[model samples]
Target: MENTKQQKTNVSSKTRTLVSAALFAGIICITIAYFLHIPIGGNGGFVHVGDAFIYLAAVLLPTPYAACSATIGAGMADILTGSANWALATIIIKPILVLFFTNKSKKIINTRNVCAAIIAGIVGTVLYMIAEGIMYGSFVSAFVLSLVGLVQPIGSFIVFVVIGLVFDKLKIKEMIK
Candidate 1:
């Protein structure tokens, strides 16, 4: 009975460690994305850094945790940047983007996944554009926002693929609890 109790404690501790690691990695990736966003519109038009990080988190962490982290991290960044008004959108969009991949976990991460990521990125970007475009009207310009959506995903895909490759090489996934 004593040994069984000790074993339970050890399992609990390991679970805590895994959760902490996932949260830490998520925050760090969010921070990286936060710094990457370029301010464009006077209100808050920008490219998100969290895109790659969200994608990475989804691939590595559990679906729920990955989605939570992506939403919280991106939303926090929006608030920090004085785009507090758009926090809801950031929170909503990031998780949905993360969920896109999480829902299809059976599929291997490869060229096809990359293409899907690209599509999701563009779709998310366009959603943001439409939201802001409504407020800014014709003056804000969808052309630039559209370009950002198109380009950022390609950049994000490259980043995620490289990170995934590194994890494969280092056998990090084997360490996941």
Candidate 2:
């Protein structure tokens, strides 16, 4: 009887943890995406720091939770900002970004993670540019204009490094244990 109760409790605790992580991470992602951004390149597109949170989610949380949060948050941000047209692209691209760099056992700045981050950034930028090219009916402006959006991925990596260090310094994983 006691063993059964303990097993149930463990499952409940894990469920709660996953649910809370998803909700909080999603909220943070959406808020960052919608409320914070920099316009550039004489085009209507903007660069936003929401990817920082997406990367953080991938680094710190389980992959499914992180992927869902990133997709939902960025997609919702697009909808709320009247760029609903980009929501589908965001949902697809952001999850791929998270999946590529996620390595819970590795340090964020390690050779593996850094290489992965650079690749992820390139993938993200290229995918977004492709989406924009399709939307704009001109590949040239989309490519040229979206180049500035690279700042977001670069900035995201920097912020990820800072947050990753802080989380490491604080022994954040131990807190869960």
TM-score of 1: 0.77
lDDT per residue (tens digit) for residues 20-59 in model 2: 6677566655655564576666444678877877776776
All candidates' TM-scores?
Answer: 0.77, 0.86
Strongest candidate by lDDT:
2
Question: Model 1, which residues run further than 4 Å from truth?
Answer: 2-14, 17-34, 102-108, 138-140
| Candidate 2's TM-score | 0.86
Top candidate by TM-score: 2
What are the lDDT scores of the predictions, listed in order? 0.68, 0.75
